[model samples]
Target: MRLAIANLHASLGGARVLRDLTLTLEGNHFIGLIGPNGVGKTTLIRAIAGLIPFEGAITLDAAPIASIPPRTRARQIAYLAQGAESHWPLSVTRLVALGRLPHLEPFRKPQAEDEAAIARAMQLADVETMRTRDVLTLSGGERARVLLARALAVEAPLLLVDEPVAALDPYHQIGVMEGLVAYARAGRMVIAVLHDLSLAARYCDRLVMLNDGNVFADGAPADVLTPANLREVYRVNAEVTGEGRAMTVRPTGQI
Candidate 1:
């Protein structure tokens, strides 16, 4: 799968959030979309998912996103939105099964293939043990994993997640990141909006830094998370250390 965005512009509430942004991405790797607050990371993902209107072209496999049907788009991009917390009393398995909707017929029940996908998703996310648990009763991390399972159940080639590790314990955070990496390595593409710079540096094969509606930097984590970028884009004095999964970005002071 290949995604290309050209001169992309997007707005919400009549206020533009992305401007003249362009990016190209392919499958089989994990990418981190890093940026300051309200800098259009979410907007970019929504545009790619065809959930919002954009002024430029977004194409998958060279096909315009607007030309793709809603169900077909849903089957291609599995988007796990931010703050997907649910208050309903649905079981984790049932919640995860919802991801298969795009592949099912109208008013039809899950078939063998759908069930296999749901079970594989649960296994990949390591949430199989909690399959019968109430999603609402799970801890913050557990809920996040279950939600991830739901997204994974779609078996989409491209997965987009927003803040997959927010408000989680360190252990669970690592688990989620590891799961994403594994998914990417398994011939899929994963792009996640991340605020945890260190985790982004450690886990992502590539990083795209956005600021003020444009890409400030794009490359490997080490190159993109430089002290200069940390200071300029994030306005902080940070120390960048190590390389690849061992790399760390530690902020020392506000710039």
Candidate 2:
């Protein structure tokens, strides 16, 4: 699948978050959306997911995203928002099953295919052990993984995740990143907003850096995560080492 955007502009509460942003996203790749805080990373994905109003052309597989039916778009893009909270006392399994709503008709029970998808999503997020637990009772980290499982259960071609590893420990962070990479390798597109620059460099093949409400750099991690780019976009004197999948970024001092 392919998503093309041109001259995109988005705002929240009348404050412009993105301006004249143009980009193209496709499947079979894991992309990292990285930048300092409040740089429009979330806004860009929200616009792509059609959660907010925007001025521009955002087309999915050549068809305008706005023109697609709501249910149809729901089946195409799965979004995992940052800091997802659930107050409902539903079981983890039941919460994850909500992702299949796009596929199941009203009042129709989940079939074998839907069950399989939910199972796989739970397993990938490492939340299968807690499937019987109450979603509202899980810890912050656990809740994040459960939400991720819900998005994965959607089985959409495009996945937009906001800070998938933000609430996790180091082990789970690495594991979640690996799962995202695997999902992209499995012929899907995964765009994750990441604050850990080193992790982003290590796991994401492509990095899109946003600054001043636009894409400042877009390319392979090695090329986009350079010290100069970090200095300019992040205002930090940084060191970037290694190459390719082994790339790492370290901020030494403020610029």
> In terms of TM-score, which candidate is strongest?
2
Score every model by TM-score: 0.96, 0.98
Model 2 misplacement above 4 A: none
Candidate 2 lDDT by residue in tens digits, 108-180: 9999999999998998898999999998888999999999999999999999999999999999998899889
What stretches of model 1 exceed 4 Å from their correct place?
none
Residue 124 of model 1 has an lDDT of 77
Q: lDDT of candidate 1? A: 0.93
Worst 10 residues of 1 by lDDT: 167-176
Per-residue lDDT of candidate 1, residues 1-255 (tens digit): 899999999999999999999999996989999999999999999899988999989999999989989899899899999988878899999999999999999999999999999998888788999988999899988998899999999999899999988967898789889988988998889999999999999999999999999999999998899999989999999989898778988899996
Which pairs of residues collide in candidate 2? none
